[model samples]
Target: MIRDLARSVREYKKVSIITPILISMEVVIECIIPFITAALVNEIKAGCGLNTIIKYGVLLILMAFFSLLFGGIAGSTSATAASGFAKNLRKDMFYSIQNYSFENIDKFLTSSLITRMTTDVTNVQNAYMMLIRVAVRAPLMLIFAFVMAFVMGGRMAWILLVVVPILAIGLGIVIYKTFPLFRKVFTKYDALNKSIQENIKGMRVVKSFVREDYEQQKFEAAAEDVCADFTKAERILALNGPLMQFCIYLVMIFVLSFGSYTIITSRGLDFDIGQFSALLTYNFMILSSLMMLSMVFVMITLAGESAKRIVEVLNEKSTLSNPENPVYTVKDGSIDFENVSFKYSEKAEKMALSNINLHIKSGETIGIIGGTGSAKSSLIQLIPRLYDATEGVVKVGGVDVRNYDIETLRNQVAVVLQKNILFSGTIKENLRWGNKDATDEELIEACKLACADEFISQFPKGYDTYIEQGGANLSGGQKQRLCIARALLKKPKILILDDSTSAVDTKTDAKIRKAFREYIPDTTKIIIAQRTASVEDADRIIVMDKGTINGIGTHKQLLAENAIYQEIYYSQNKAGDQDEN
Candidate 1:
C-alpha cells in the first residue's frame, strides 16, 4: 500500500511534495496552540494578576488565529493538488486504455472500464486530499500531544501510555475485519455501474419489448447488493468510535483519582491543582489525537486498495506499442497477410482468423463478404496493427506492419467502423477531424463524394449545422454519410468501409461507390458488407467463412466459381437480377 501511494506521489511530484509540507506546518501550529493554552492556565494559577492572565490569553488567541489561517491555506492547496492529480491520472488512464490491444480490452467490460475511470479515480482523489489534511495532521497532533503530556506531568503520562495500546488493538480488529469488506464494495460498485450503463444504452430495446419493469428489477437488485456491502463495512467500522471513547473515559477516571490524591497529600507545595488540571487536558488531547489518527488509518487502508487498482491501469504496458526501429515511409499502399493467425485469448482454441494469406495491391477496390463471426473486420484491423497476429506476419507497402511506426502505419489507413460515432460539433467541424488542414473546397468535395452534401445543405445551417452527441440530430443514413465524408477527407492511401453504407438505400450506396471510382482512383479501398450488391462491383471479392477465405476473385468470377458468394449474391439481388445483368 505504501509503495502504491509513493508511486501516485511520484506521478505528481511537485504538487505532492508542496501539499504535504503545507499541511505539516499547519498541523504543527494546531498542536502548539493547546500547549500555549496549558501554559496560560499555569500562569493564572501562579498568583498571576488579571493583566498577566489577559496577556497569556491574548497570546493563545493569536496562536489560534495563525493556526486557522495556515490550516485554511493548507486545505485549499491540498484540494488543488488532488483535483489536478485526478485529472492527469484520468487522462493517463484513458491514453493507456487507448493503447491497449483489442484483445486486452476484451478482457474487461466497457461499463467496468467506465467505472474505474470515473468513480474509482474519484475515490483515490478524495482519499488523497484527506491524507494531505486529516491523515498528516492527525499523526503530527498525536505525536505532539504525547510529547507535551510527558513534559507537563511525568507519571501522569502513563494515562496515554495505557490508552494508546487499547486504541491500537481496537483499530486493528476493526481494520482486519473491514479490509475484505472494502474489496467486496468495489466489486459491487462495478456490477452496479454495469447494470446502469447497460440499461441506458439498451433502453430502446427494453422499451420496444415493454420490459421496463424487468429492467428496473434488475437494476434494483444490483443497487441492493452494493448498498448491503457498504452497510456491512460501515457497521463494522462504526464500532471504533464507541470502543475508543469507552477506553479513554476509563483512563480519565484513573487520572482524576490520582491527581486528586496527589494534590491532597502535597501540603504547602508549589504543585497546584490547576496545573494538574492542565495536565489532564493535555492527556485528553493526546487520546483524541489517537482516535483521529486511527480513523485516518482506516481510510488510508481502503484508499490504498483503490489506488492499487488505478495504478494497475496506469502501469500497464501496451502490447501493441510502436517498435523501436520502424518503417516510416511507404512507396505503395499494398497489404499482405502471410500465414497469419489470431485468437482473442490464448486459452481459446478457436482462432478469430487463421492461416490467412492474401495480397491487396495499390489502387485496387477489394470487397470482403463473410458470414457472421468469420473475422471480416478482424482481417482488415491487422493492416493498421490494431492487433498483432499470434503467428506469421502482416505486411503493408512491402514492409511488415509491426516494423512501421504506429502513427505512420495508421496515417495511411482510414477505417469507418460499422458503428458510426460523431463528436458534438458542427457538421463541418466533425468532417475536419479527418483532415485538419483541409480547405473549404476539399471539405465540400469530400462531402459530395460521400453523398452527404445534399442532406447537409438542406439543414438550417448547411455545413455549419450543429450535430448532437453521436450525431443524434441526424438520421442513421445521414450519420453514415458524415462518417464516410470524415474518412474521405483524410485522403488516406487505403480506405476501408466496414458496412459503412448499411444504413443508406441501395441507390445512395451505388452513388457513393460511383463517386469513389472517379474521385479516389489512386486510393486502395476495402469494403466489408453483408449485402452482396455493395461489393459486387469491386475489382476483387474475397469470401470468408469460419476464419478462412473460402474464395477470392472478381464479382463475375465469384458468381461462376464460388458457391457461398454466388448464393449471397443471388439472394440479395433476386428482384434486381435483370437490371444487374
Candidate 2:
C-alpha cells in the first residue's frame, strides 16, 4: 500500500526530498541555540567584557536567522510536494475509472469513489505535509535536545527517561483505541455523502412527492453516524493533552527541585545557574517534540484508512483491456452472439442473460421489446463490449470483441444508453463530444435527424446556448433528442439506442427512425423500446423474456405466431383505443 501511494509523488520527488533536508538543518540550528545561550549566560555571570557578550549575542542571532530561513523554505516545499501528490492521486484515480469496464465500475459505489477522490485525498495530503516536515523535525529535535541536556546537566538529564516512557505508553493506548474509531468514521462519511448525493440528484422527485422530511431524516441519520464515530475517536484522542501536560509538569518539578539543591549544596560547581536554565530549555524542546510526534501519530491514524481506500482504486485493473495485438479497424456493423451467458458478478446466483444465440447482419434495422428486468439493455450492451459475456463469444464485425482495440471498437459502435447525460457546456460543445472536428453543417444535419434542431433553434443562442448539468433546463423530450443527435454525430457503423427515444412523441420518434433509414441505412441500427408501434416498422423485432430470446422475427410474423408479442401489441393498442374513446 505504501509503495502504491508513493508512486503518486512522481514529479514532486525532488521537493519531497528537499523538505526533510531543510527541516533537519532547522532542527540542528535550534538545538545549538539553547547550548549557545547557556554558554553566553556563564560568560556574563563571570563578568565578561562587552566585546565577549556582543560576540556571543551576534553568533546566537546568526544561528536563529539560519534556523528561520531553513524552516520557512521547508514549509513552502512541503506544501508544494503535498499539493502535487494530491493532484496526481486524483488524476490517477480518475483515469483508472475512465478505463474501467462497466463490470469493474459496478464493484464500487459512485459515492464511495467520490469520497476517496476528494475527502480521502485531502486527509492523505495533510498527513504527507506533516510527514515530510514536522515528522522529520520532531525526532531530530528530540534527539539533539536530549543529547545537549545530557552534556550540560549530566545525571539530571535522566529525568527525561522516566517521562519519555510514560508518554510513549500513554500515546500507544490512545492511538490503539482511536484508530478503529477513525476507520469507522470515514466509512460513515461515505454513507453520509451517498445520502446527500441521492437527495440532490433526485430533488425534483423528492419535492413532487413531498418527501422533504423523509430525506432530511435520512440525511440526519447518516450525519449522526459520522458524528458519533468522530466523537468517540476525539474522546480517546483527548487523553494525549492531559497525559503530555502531566509529564511536562512532572519533569519540570523534578528538574527545578534537583538542580536548585545541587547548585546550593555544591556552591554552583556541580550544577550551576547557567546549566540549570539550559536544562529547562532542553526539557521544553524534548517534551514539545514528543507532543509533535503524538500529533503526527494521530494524523497518521486518520490517514491510514484513507490511504487504503485510495490504493484500492489505484491498484484496480480494468476487467476489460485491449488485446496484446489488437485489430484497429471494424470491418462492418455485423454482430454475432453464440451461446452467450452473462451475470453481473461472479457471486450472482442467476445470470442476467443466458443462452443467447442471435446474429445481426450489417445495416439491418433491429428492434427489441421486453418488460422491465428482462435484460433488454444487457443484450445490446454486449455488442459494444461494455460488459464482456461471462460465457461464450460475442463478435462484432466478424471479430471477437476482446480481439479489437477497445477505443476503435467503441468509436465504431455508438450507444445512447437509457440514461441521457448532458454535461454543463454550450449545446455545440456537448454535441462535439461525438465528433470533435464536426463542422457546423454536420452538427445541424445530425440535429435535424434526431429532431433536436427544432428546439435548439428556438433558443436565442441556438447551438451556442448553454446547457445546465444533465440538461436540467431542457424538457425530457428535448434532452433525449439532443442525446440522439450527439450519437448521430458519431457516424458509427453500429448505433444502439437503448430506449433513448421514450421521452419523444411518437411522430418525432418516427421521424428519427425515418432519418436513420434514409440517411444512414448502412449503419446497423438497434432500437430498444416499450411501445410496440416503435418496432412494428423495423425489418425484424426480438422478444426477450427472463434473459433469453423468446422469439425473433418480423413484427407482423411475431404478432401472428408469438403469444408474448400478441399480448404486448394487443394490450398497447387496446390502451390507445380506450384513450381515444
Candidate 3:
C-alpha cells in the first residue's frame, strides 16, 4: 500500500522532502524558546542589569520568530506537496480506469470510484500534510521538552514516568477501538454516494413514476447509515480530548505540589524559582505535544481507511493490455470468431457467449436480431475486443485481436453501444471525438449520412450548438442520431450499431442504413435491431438465440424457414398489416 501510494508523489517528492526538513528546523528553534526564558529568569534573580535581561528577551523573540518562519515555509511547502499528491492520485486512478475493459469496470461501482477520487483522495491529502508537519513536530517537541525537564528538575521528572504510561495506554486503547469503526464508516460513505448518484441520474424517472417520495426515503436511509456510523466513531474519538486534558492537569498538579515542597525544603538550593519556572514551561510543552500527537493519531486513524481505498484503485491492474509487440494497422474490416466462448467472470457457471464461430468479410453488411438474452451485444463486443474471448481466438483483419495494439484495434472498430453518451460540449466538439482533425464539412457530411443534419440545422446553433451532459437537451431520437453521426465521423472499417437507432422512426432508420450502404460501402456493418425492416436489405442476417447463432441467411430465407425469425417478422408485420378506415 505504501509503495502504491508513493507512486503518485512523483514530481512532488522534492517538496515533500523539503517540508520535513523545514519542520525539523522549526522544532529546533521551538525547543530553544523555553531555555531562553529560563536564562532570563536567572538573570532577573541574580539582579542583573536591565541590559542583560533585555538581551535574553531579544534572543527569545528571535527564536520564536525563526520558529514561525520555518513553520510558515513548511506549511506552504506541505500544502503544495499534498495538493499535488492528490492531483496526481486522481490522475493516476482516472488513467487506470481508461485502460479497464468492460469486465474490469464491472468490479467497481461508478459511485465508489467517484468517492475514491474525491473524498478518499482528499482525506489522504490532509493526512499527508499532517504527517509531514505535526507528526514531525510533536514527537520531537515532546522528546526535547522531556529532556530539558529532567535536566532542570531531576528526580521529580519521575512523576511523569507513571503518569505518561497510563495516559498512553488509555489513548492507545481508544484509538484501537475506533480504528475499525472508521473503516466501516467509509464503506457507508460509498453507499451514501451511490444513493446520491442514482437519485440524480434517474431524477426524471423518479418524477415520472411519482416515486420522488420513495427515492427521498431511500436516500435518507443511506445518509442516516453514514451519519450513524460516523456518530459512533466520532463519539469514541471524542474521548481523546477529555482524556488528554485529564492527564495534563493531573501531571501539572503533581509537578507543582512536588516542586513547591522541594523548593521550600531545599532552602533555595536544589530547585530554584528560575529552574522551577523553566520546568513548568517544559511540562506544558511536553503535555501539549502529546495532545497534538493524539490529534495526529486520530487523523491517521481516519485516513488509513481512505488510504486503503485509494490504494485499491491505484493497484488495480487493467485486465486488458496491449501486446508488447503489436500490429499497428488493420488490413481490412474482416472479422472472424473461432470457437469463442466467454463469460464475464472466471467464477461464472455459464458463458455469456459460447462456441461462436462466424466470419464476416470486409464490405459485407450483416444484420442481427435476438431476444433480450440472446447475446446480440455480447457477440458484437468481441469484434472490437471490448471483452476478449475466453476460450478461442477473435481475429480482426485476419489477425488475432490480442496481437493488435488495443488502441489501434479499437480505433478501426467503432461501436455505438446500446447506451448513447454525449458529453457536455458543442455538437461539433462531440463529433470531433471521432476524428479530431475533421473539417466542419466532414462533420456535416457524417451527420447527413446519419440523418442528423436536418434536425441539427433546425437548432439555432446548428453544428455549434451546446449539448448538455448526456445530451439531455435533445430528444431520444435526436441523441441517437447525433451519436450515430459521431460514430460515422470515425469512418471506421467496422461499425457496430447495437440498437443505436431504436429511437428513430422506421423510415429514418431505413435512410440511415441507406446512407451507410452508399457512403461507406467498404466498411463492414453489423446492425443489431428488433425491427425486421432495419435488417431486410442486409447482405445476410443472423438470428442469435441463447448465445448461439440460430440461423444465417437472407431476410426472405429466414422468414420462410426459421421459426424464431418468422415469429418476429410476423409479430411486427401483423401489427403493420392492420388498417383503420
Candidate 4:
C-alpha cells in the first residue's frame, strides 16, 4: 500500500514536495506561538517589568499571525496539488480503459468502473490533501512540544513518556480494528452504485412493471447494510478521542502534583513554579498533537484500501497490446481470417467462432446474416482488432493484424456498432468527432450519403441543433442515420455496419445503401443485418449458424442452394403474404 502511494505521489513530483514544505512552515509557526506564550507567562510569574512582558506578548501575537499566513498558503498549495493529481490520474485511467479489449472490459461492470473513476478518485484526493495539510503538522508539533517540555522542567517530562505510550496502544487498536471495516465499506459502496445505476437506467421497465416499491425496498436494504457496517467501524474508532482525553487528564494531574511537590521541597528553587506552568502548557500541546495523529491514522487506513483498488486498475496489463516493434501501416483494406476461433472465456468448452476461414477483398461489399449469437458481429469486430482471435491469425492488408500499431490499424476501420451512442452536442459537433479536421462541405456530403441531411435540415436549428444526452431527443431511426453519417465522415478504408440500420424503414435503408454506393469509393463495406432485403443486393452473403458459416454466396444463390437461408427467406415472405391476406 505504501509503495503504491509513493508511486501515486511520484506522478506529481514537484507539487508533492512543495506541499509538504509549506505545511511544515505552517506547523513551525504554530509551535513557536506556544513557546512565546510560555515565555510571557513565566515573565509575569517572575515579576518582570511591564515593558518586558508587553514585548513577549506582542511577539506571541506575531507568531499567531505568521501561523495563519502559512496555514493559508499550505491549504491552497495542498488543494491545488490534490486536484491536479486527481485530474491526471483520471485522465490516465480513461486512456488506459480506452485501450482495453472488449474481453478485458467485460470483467468489470459499467457501474463499478464509474464508481472507481469517480468516488474512488475523490477518496484518494481527500486522503492526499489531509496528508499534505495535517500529517506534517501533527508530528512536528509533538516533537516541538516534547523538546520544550524537557527544557522547561526535566522531571515533569516523564508524565509525557507514560501518556504517549498509552495513546499509541489505543491508536493501534483503533487502526487494527477499523482498517478491515473500511475495505468492507468500499465493497458495499460498489454494490450500492450498481443497484442505483441499474434502477435508473432501467427506470422505464421499473415503472411499466410497477416495481417501484420493490426497488425502494431493495435499495433500503443495501443502504441499511452499509449503515450498519459504517456504524460498527465508527463505534470502534470513536473510542480513541475519549480515551485520549482521559489519558491527557491523568498525565496533567501527575505533572501538576509532582511539580508542585518539587517546587516546595527544593528550596534552592532550581526549577521554579513559572517553569512548572510552562511544562503544563507544553504537555497539553503534545496531547493535542497526539489526538491529531490518531485521526491521520484512520484516514491513512481508508486511503490505503482505496490506493490498493486504484493500483489494480493502473497496473493491469492489457491483453490486446500490439506486438513490440510493430509495423507502422496497413497498405489496403483486405481482411483474412485463417482457422480463427474465439471464446469469451477459456473455461468455456464451446467457441463463439470456430475454424472460421474467409477472405474479404478491398472495395467489396459483403453481407453477414445469422441467428442471434451466431458470431456475425464477432467476426467483423476482428477486422478492427476489438478482440484478438484465440487460436488463429487475423490479417489485414496481407499482414497479421497484430503486426500493425493498434491505433494506426483501428483508424483505418470505422465501425458503427449495433448499439449507437452519441454524445451531447449539436449535429455538426457530433459529426466532427469522426474527423476533427473535416471541412463543412465534407460534413454535409457525408450526411447526405447517410440519408441524414433531410431530417437534420428539418430541425429548427438545422446542423447547429443541440442534441440531448445519448441523442434522447432524436428518434431511433434518426439516431441510426446520424451514426452512419459520423462513420462516413471518417472516410475510412473499411466501413462496418453491425446491424446499424435496424431502426430505419426498408425504403430508407435502401436509400442509404444506394447513397453509400454513390459516395464511398474503394471502401470495403461489411454489413451485418437481420432484414433479408437489406443484404440481398450485396456481392456476397455469408449466412452463419451456431458460430460457423453455414453458407456463403450471393442472395439468389443462397436462396437456391442453402436450406437454412431458404427457410429464413421463405418464412419472411410467407409472413408478408399472410399479412396481406
Per-model CA lDDT versus the true structure: 0.83, 0.93, 0.89, 0.84
Q: How accurate is candidate 3 locally (lDDT)?
A: 0.89
Cα lDDT of model 4 by residue, 466-563, tens digit: 99988889998999999999998878888999999999999999998887777775888999999888999888999999889999999989987998
Model 1 CA lDDT for position 79? 80
Q: What is the TM-score of each candidate against the true structure?
A: 0.93, 0.98, 0.97, 0.92
Model 4, global lDDT: 0.84
Off by over 4 Å in 2: 575-581
Ranking by lDDT: 2, 3, 4, 1
Best by TM-score: 2
Please report, as a residue range, the 10-residue window in candidate 2 with the lowest summed lDDT: 572-581
The segments of candidate 3 whose C-alpha lies over 4 angstroms from its true place after superposition are 265-268, 575-581
Tell me the tens digit of each residue's lDDT in model 1 across 1-581: 45644544545667666767776776677666666776677777677899988887788788788777777777778888788878877887898898888777887778778878887888888888887777777777778767877776677777777778888888889888888888878777888888888888777789999999998998899999989878998999999879878877887788777777777887426455655765677777677777777777778777777777777777767778777887888667788999999876789878889899999999999999988888899898888888889899999899999898898888789999999999999888999999889888999999999999999888888988999877777899999999999999888889999999999999999999999999898899999999988998999999999999999999889888998887787777776566556
Tell me which of candidates 2 and 3 scores higher on TM-score.
2
Which candidate gets the maximum lDDT versus the true structure?
A: 2
- Residue 578 CA error for candidate 3 (Å)? 8.8
Clashes of 3: 0
* 575: Cα error in model 4, Å: 6.2
